[model samples]
Target: MEQQNWSLATYCVAPHVAGTATLQGARLTDFGGLSVPIHTSSTYKVDSAEQGAVLASRKGWPELRKDGSTAKDEFFYSRWRNPTVAAVAAHLAALERAEGCLLFGTGMAAISTSVLSAVKAGDHIISQSSVYGGTFHLFSHYLRESFAVQVTFVNIEDLNTLERYIRPNTKVIYVESPSNPTLRLVNLEHIASIGKKHNILTIIDSTLATPINQQPLTLGIDVVVHSATKFLSGHSDLTAGAVLSNSQDFLKQVLFLQQTLGSTLSPFDAFLLARGLKTLHLRVSHQNNAALKIAHFLDTHPKVKVVHYPGLSSHKDFHLAQRQMSNGCGGLLSFELLGGREDGRKVIEHLQVINLAVSLGSVESLVEQAATMTHSQLNKEDLSEAGIDESLIRLSVGIENVDDLIEDLRQALEYV
Candidate 1:
């Protein structure tokens, strides 16, 4: 069978258009189906040992597609690469405006692989204090304790003093925009500029603000990482992660780490991820609208002490968010209760439509107390620094009706 061209379609596709018609990098089959076919084979059969060596080494396979393009980095072992995964990566690369992308078994796998690819045992890292709990643990504990790496958690707003924290050995400045639970945003352009000036790699975990809402690479960040398990997957069905970058060299390092770490995403999971990505724009747009409405409702409620949502004018970083995430402030928000932890507990118990669970970015709404849920590992002092308290309730708005969501929140607040 002659292999057809798997290049992106001829149409000039926009980044946010993830509908079936605009799904990029679909390899056409003889049947001419529009859907991306799942390549489930763990390994490919090569005609000779020479061809196998060529595929394994990824030195540009001799096999040519009908379009006169060689299958550079063709599939040999599933652990190294797979057709299904590569196709979805292409779509993600286009969406993220990155030169390349790599998939991993989980979000942590992606984060760990990307960071490890950049630094060794004694390298230093500067990270924002309000990153996701898992990332915090990876840096503060595993990387620090195991590898003797020096990590300084900084307040990104202190741009004037950030240079003081930098060391000649500093390799990466990591941060999360519209950071988890708090909904606080970092100045992406400034951070990117600082990284460039210092010749340091800048990486952002853009899970909260999906590429539909924000593209960090365009802001000059070196690399963008996502817990594709969140908004990218858009459903609670699959677990996957992605690391995207404009630097092919960085992506190559990530790819090598992914292959060595054996964190490759399976063909079926990659297929599901691709399917979820098809409606990315549609789902996120609805989520953005609903979240803003709910944020407004919570902001004005008497029982709420403070609502952390960049969409709200009262938010500290509203202007920064507007500058970076022009599409929307995303679907996540958090509010502290005036009555403290007891009131927060009552609110969670009374919610009917929203599930009292941990993960976010699903079709269904989820609510959780950050201190006890997502950021539980952070100690009391650490939690305070992250601006998380026992009274804070994080809400992940879904594609549900805004009125119903507001009503549900209203009734829940009434219980408090």
Candidate 2:
């Protein structure tokens, strides 16, 4: 028999042959006509008892096996693995250049699952001090209280600081580069080297950078996590998260937890995320350009006390960012209003074009008071320690007209 050339559309159309390779690249089309029609199916039909046995076995059909085995039987249920989700996961894995990828209901689900799967009770975790508010709470409170997991928050900029915080029991080092709200950049290669020295697993939240801007795994980091809710799903229409790892063993463990914890993403959401990823390169590049322009504008503004963006030369991590990220800094940036908390509030209230919102990474510009909105859970001292000021406003630059965005910011800052 003549061999046939296989494409994403080919595998997607015949989902039963849902090979892991199917998700490796941009397979779906903007139009509905493609290799695979939306497998809007919750369940599939079983052909025979022997076929069912094969599906339940460790080995499956050529389409389901990583080795491409022709042995029939693999997929039993959607929860364990759906063709749609598998296709998306495979594509994401390729994007991050990792061994495999696992999807989750939300960004937090991905973070928590990776942490929980990698670290056990009594294991220490070293993380960046300035992280997302929800993640901060998860590490500081939930993990500590429930699992007796210990976490040390270190200043990622100072290698000595992070080194001193690492304990003998440390199993993993977690960090968020260009950290939430503050835009603090962490050194991926340096940290990965440190983790390798101690045989510790390193995981990074690359949601802000997206694969288009940065690939932490390539820097020697063991694992990479993303809240696809932000830039990956640029329209903010879907909430999803993903974990990509280079180790098959580690990927199995994380996938096992995902199955047991029941935090898997829905097929529909998976489809949306797959679609969102197709344009990721274009979207992130546009946002990076706009953010750099806006950051420079804010840096020179008289009413702005300070601008926290890696693209800005004055930023402490500008050089590091330039070395690590391929594209540019990122769309998210923060600026401290000169007039303090009141000024921050005024800027938000006065904005007409930019929406006053909490979440970011959308097509429309959004502005918010970080201390009051996103990082409100942090106490005054913690906020100060994280470089979050009472007057700080976080900006998620959109693909809007730069002139219009600047005009909006100009008027908003004028309120101060």
Q: Deviation in angstroms for 104 in model 1? A: 0.9
Candidate 1, residues 83-166: lDDT per residue as tens digits?
778777777777776777788889999999999999998899999898899999999999999999999998656644677899
lDDT of 2 by residue, 224-338 (tens): 9999889888887899999988787787788778878989889888878877776676777788999999998999999999999999889898888889988788889999977
The C-alpha RMSD of each candidate to the native structure, in angstroms, is 3.2, 4.6
Q: Which ten residues in a row have the lowest lDDT in candidate 2?
A: 63-72
Instruction: State how far residue 388 of model 2 sits from its true place (Å).
Output: 1.0
Residue-level lDDT for 54 in candidate 1: 73
Best by lDDT: 1
- The collision pairs in model 1 are none
